[model samples]
Target chain A: MDEEWIKTTDKKIINLIRLTRKNTLDYINKDINVSTKTTRKDLVTNVDKSNEQFLVNNIREIDPKSKILGEEGFGDNVNSMSGHVWIIDPIDGTMNFVKEKNHFAIMLALYIDGKGILGYILDVMQNKLYHGIFGKVYENDKEIFSPKNISLNNGLMGMSAPLLINDYDNMQSIAHKSSGVRIYGSAGIQFISVIKGELIGYISHLKPWDIAAGKVMCDSLGITVTTIDGNALDMVSSETVLIATKIAHKEILDLVK
Target chain B: MDEEWIKTTDKKIINLIRLTRKNTLDYINKDINVSTKTTRKDLVTNVDKSNEQFLVNNIREIDPKSKILGEEGFGDNVNSMSGHVWIIDPIDGTMNFVKEKNHFAIMLALYIDGKGILGYILDVMQNKLYHGIFGKVYENDKEIFSPKNISLNNGLMGMSAPLLINDYDNMQSIAHKSSGVRIYGSAGIQFISVIKGELIGYISHLKPWDIAAGKVMCDSLGITVTTIDGNALDMVSSETVLIATKIAHKEILDLVK
Candidate 1:
């Protein structure tokens, strides 16, 4: 809970994300040496595991007492956000990373005693780091202006493709009402768009790692991060989640409910 | 038909696009003066008109005898692609340019007696220009390799959101068949992705300006650009289009037909 601890952790996380970006790019481009945990024949599959391991190992060294939950099963099997909890999605949008090589992201969030203390989402291709320390959000070094809390009708939305196709909770109708819909195939990248006000919201069926960093960033911007049923989300369960500008939140909730 | 003519035209077009990028960004970011054909209070509306005018005027000087067809009505209303025809979409995704300031493009294509001679699609935000001359495609200075001719099941797809929602020609089912779907709100950007082999195909209802440049680039890369009905697309009308790898083209057509 100490301010000093938050500041130092923020610095370390940014550096770690940069390192992850370099190493991942190296691995993907086949520039990394095979001796450092991979076969040269197929570099993509090992990326999630190796990258998550890299993040977990560095995070462990940075905060020895914290419980880390990672997407590739490299960390603790955290079921509760008690004490110091670090939730990581080392290579979010793996398909995009493999197929497109452009829209995926790397994310980390730190919660202290169930309170989101810090979060980071690195849009690797764009080389932009969006983060929140305590309640203020920043893009790289500049503090982000709070996105206008526009309604669903006036804003662009992002959602998982399957949800829209299935019309889950009126998603097809929701897509119609929105100015447009974009599916970048990554929650972290979608969160960055929402944080920057390019997308007014993102709705997806997401796991804790998929939605955890987003919850921290959205809360910092006064954007709503909640379950589709308009309930608070615990940082453990997979749920249908909607992260949006405040008014869009209420509008989307009304339509789906 | 001359190689020298195509080479010179390519150089001139690239220079023109660089200038267009500078002016467009200035207009959007409010760095340009109000005297430059816009009122300071609302610049978004004027962008399409002014940008098209800029391109049209330059094209006239570059190739005096050529006929121009422009999206913003700055040029001819010709119904035929004959003798040195240039089609332009100065701001291909005005909604995106105004809404997200990303995923939009400036497209220009030259058709000589019904044959695509040269084409360009500049993804302004990412600063990528996908272009073709005769039968070769290049990204900036480097020639682009042909994308792997993957099947529909092996590749990602892009579609217009409305079509996907309406299930036009079983689009929702098609969504399930492909690896996944993305809706990026601009035909030109989507075309760039396909040219780069990021998306195997893009299906959309597009205007002449929207599909002309794409036709040229896709043809150069040996990618198939056709009507959803598996017919050739003449560069003079709006139509439901599919720009895909060869195998994926047949697969997608079989689904809809």
Candidate 2:
């Protein structure tokens, strides 16, 4: 994809996201019709599927030859980030959507031949959108600078309940050494907190759709996003993801390692 | 205070809270000048003191002879909840206010002759107020019905990081048995979640101002508010507080025991 063409596509995709906001809000305000996936903890709702279909259809209309990897399987079975691929998680925090009715997001990203071109994460209820183009991050229309570099002992950390209980990779110690721990039950919400400089870092076992959009946003802001160990992220597979400031990143990896 | 007098007082207090919203918002949006209280984790800002003074001055004008218990130490030190006492936590979750700027709240409660007459928790950013009058709970003037009676394993629980890390009273086991765990870092926010039926229970070590208003609201909705060991809460002292749906309360007590 050409650079100029990618800019045009970004505007179109953002408008599409804004257009779908009302329908998603309606579904969230009303009773959510839900069904379980692999486990009872894993939930899928009508809104999740409908939102995915809505995005996938519009993307297909805009770029007929583009490949899309969607959470609800409405798009292609993308094995790799080939030319002109869009990755989306229509509703990243489906459990929060079903139960709390807040703290969830609509995440979408665009890649051109294995390189991220654009990323967007829209917090549905708050109406706040985090977008990144190439290597610039923006909240709404204003570009966001890098958050202050704080260490693990001076800032809060977000963790998964499963990891905390099982003490996976010495997570308990990582949590103990941080200023405090917060668990909002949504990976997207946690990611936004880090982007806004509220949380020092976030660690959880996440699928590709869960971290794809967030990863781009973090990378643009000079934040570190990698596995529990200091390693590069495999964008096509589920991995133990850790996102943090530079100082906290090294401290957490040392403890968890 | 008589019943009619209490009603009038509630109206006046609500108006005062509404009037103070602008000043609080100004402080939060602008630079918040913060100071350390006992430790760095325990924070007190200029806004906290100003909000406390605002409430105390208004309450004194209304009832000059009344006693007040305040977090900022601007009010009277009443050893007993003798008559016409007010408890105010100018800003519950100050850490959240200073850090997140969205999850903190203004909490106030009125007790007449050692009986809870009114309680209010205002989520400043969201403009949602949770109040109760003598066993009747309301969310911004709309009456709230009782939350469903769900047991521990069937519902989500909100807990604190200290409790989880120390495994206080076997908290880790309780968290493991529940559907999942959530930590919002604000006791008032967690209380509102329970009142709104989003969380089954919330447990934390809280001061009197932290839980006084929330206790009144939860009791009105038939939710259990008590010590972790199932003992009655001491109204004038700090203690470990647990707010939960009735069934979950009993189950958690059994497990902790």
Candidate 3:
């Protein structure tokens, strides 16, 4: 993507995200009926589906040729990361949305020919939008500086419930070594915490939409975005994801092994 | 205290809490320095001491017979809660204040003749206040009804860092059974979440001041607030505190045993 074209796309995407925010708030202020998803613990709501459709329609109008991989099945049947692809989770942390009415996020990512070109994660309740175009990342409009490479022993970490319960990848030990642990129940919110230095790292099992935008934002800040074992993640599947500062990543990976 | 006298004192305490808010915000917006308390992770700032003094001075002027037990040493040294005793944690979650600039709380409670009479927990950054006098509780000015007595399997739970890592009182198993686990790093914030029905319960090792205000608030809602083993908490020392909805309390106590 050329510089001018990239800038134009970024502006359009930002506008679309702001529109999504308005729609989400409208639904929340009104009555919402929630339903369960895959398991008794997993949740989905009418608002989630409506939000995804709204985002998909706008995104399609912005770039008709682009393929969308959305959480609510309103997007294209995408299999390969070829050409232009927009991945979105209209409402990440659906459980939080249904239960707490906070801590949920809207995330979107654009990849061109297998390369990430842009990303956005909006913390709806807080009205904080973290975005990155190519190598530049910003929170709202202010440029964010990379935090010091603090190690696990000196910083806080975020973990998923399933991983902690099962001791998957020795996560229990990794959590024990970190200064402390936090679980906000949202991948996008957790990513924002790591980027802002509020949390040193975050690990969880995430689908592509759950982490696509967050990964792009982290990459721009030189934060480590990889598997729990320091391996590359498949962008099209659910995987154990880890995002952290450089030293914290190394420390966590060492413990996982 | 009789109903008429209690109602009058409630109004006065509420006004005092609102006034204390202004002073705390002034310190936060200004440039301030922080120092460590017992450990590197434990922190205290000048803002904390100033807030405590401000609250104490106002309380003293409001009621001269009161004995204050404050986190800072400015309050009167009272060994027994036999009279009008005020317990205050100037800034709960001090580490969060120095680091995240959020998730900290201001807590105050009044015990009349060893019985809790009034409580306040102010979420400074969000500007939300939860207070109760005797059996009536309010959030800001709106009255709060009792939350549903959801069990452990159906609601989120909060745990402390040390407790989670050590799996103390079989917390690991209890966390595994709950709908999910959350660690917001502040007992006051955790309590607010539980009272608001965002979390079903919260367990942590807390000092008297840390859980004092929260305990009083929970009591009004018919929520169970006690030790991990379903025993009454000592009002003058640190203990393993558990605050939860009724069914959740029984379920957790069973697991702990």
Candidate 4:
């Protein structure tokens, strides 16, 4: 892929995703009826489905041959990551958006021939975006240098709810060694923390869209992004994902596995 | 004790505490000298010790004969609440202040003749203070009504790190029943959430200063503040404290105990 073309498309997609987030926020904040998608486990408000549809429509217009893997079923059911692929999570932290009205984000990533080309994470409340073009990562407009590589004991770590409780692969022991564990219920926020070096690492069982953008951003920053067992991440599948600095990643894998 | 007198002293104490928080934020944000007070577990940076000393001096100047219970040991060792007593946590979330440079708070509570007269929790980052005077509760300058009674299954809950892992008295079961759990490593932020009706409740093994202001604010809002076993809180002792609305409180206590 041409680097200049990737940069241009990345900027366009980033703006589109930001617009989608703004629309989603406005829609949810408006007086709209809310219905449960499933008892309590899943929720499909109008904003969520509508935002996904909006992203799909824009991406289809821009890249007619690309495949989209979205949280909502509006996008095609992608089983492989060949050619150009766009992975999106319209409203990443749905629970926080619905309940607390804060701490949610918009995530989008582009992959060409199974290689991550662009990544973007928009933190809605903070109004900041962590984005990467090709191999260069930026927070908002300025380039963000890689954070200091601190061990788990010296930094905070973000853990998902399920991993914390069930000790998913001995996460409890790993959490004990860290300064502390913070669970924000949003993969995007967790990923941002990992990139900012505020958190040594973030671990969770995530879908493709949840980890797609994060994986590219973390990898570009010289941080390690992989499964809990130190296996390479399969971009097309849902699996346990870990994003961390090199030292923290090794420490966590050793402690957990 | 006259109610009018209690009200006057409460307002004065809240003002003093707010000023102390401003001083702490100033000191922490800039370069400051620090020394280890005791073991690494118990830290006494210049900001921590100086903030407490400032609070104690102000309390002495305002109420010469009042008893004071403070975290930094600058005040007299208060054994009983015979007269006016002020419980102060100069820097409530020290680890967060030292590590993250945010998410910490200053907590202050006034008890007149063993009764809570005033409570204040300053969320430094958001710049909002959850305060209580007599029967009214305010977040910053605006009065906030108590949140609707929400069940454990419908709301989020906050818990301390240790309790979550050790399953201290079966807290895991209680957490499992709630919609989700959040651990922010700051008693002040956790308490603010409870006051704002964000979290159904917050649980932790807390010192008197850690729980004092939050307890008074929750009490004023018709929320229940007690030990995990449903015992009234002892203002001078550290215990497993649980603060929640009526229904969520009962449900969690039932599951935990």
Model 4 lDDT per residue over A176-214, tens place: 888788888889988987887677788999989899998
Task: Write candidate 3's Cα lDDT for A41-93 as tens digits.
Answer: 78888888998999999989888999999998999999989889999999998
Q: Model-by-model lDDT, in order?
A: 0.86, 0.88, 0.86, 0.83
DockQ category of candidate 1: acceptable
Task: Note the DockQ of each predicted structure.
Answer: 0.48, 0.61, 0.54, 0.54
Evaluating just chain A, the predictions reach TM-scores of: 0.93, 0.97, 0.97, 0.95
Model 4 agreement with the true structure over B67-148: per-residue lDDT tens digits? 9999988888988877888888888777777766778888888887788878888877667788888788998779988876
Interface RMSD of each: 4.6, 1.5, 1.8, 1.5
Could you tell me which 10 consecutive residues in candidate 1 chain A have the lowest summed lDDT?
A34-43
Best of the two (1, 4) by DockQ: 4
lDDT of predicted model 4: 0.83
- Per-residue lDDT of B1-257 in model 1, one digit per residue for the tens? 79998899889999999999888888888642222123221123577778789999999999999999998788998788879999998888766777788889999998999999989999998888888986888888799989999998767898988899899998988888898898888889899889999999999998899999988988878899988999988788889998899999999999998
Give model 3's DockQ, 2 decimals. 0.54
Question: Which lDDT tens digits does candidate 2 get at residues B160-194?
Answer: 98888778989999998887899988888999999
Q: What TM-score does model 2 achieve against the real structure?
A: 0.94
Candidate 1 colliding pairs: none
| RMSD to true structure for each model, in Å | 4.4, 2.1, 2.6, 2.7
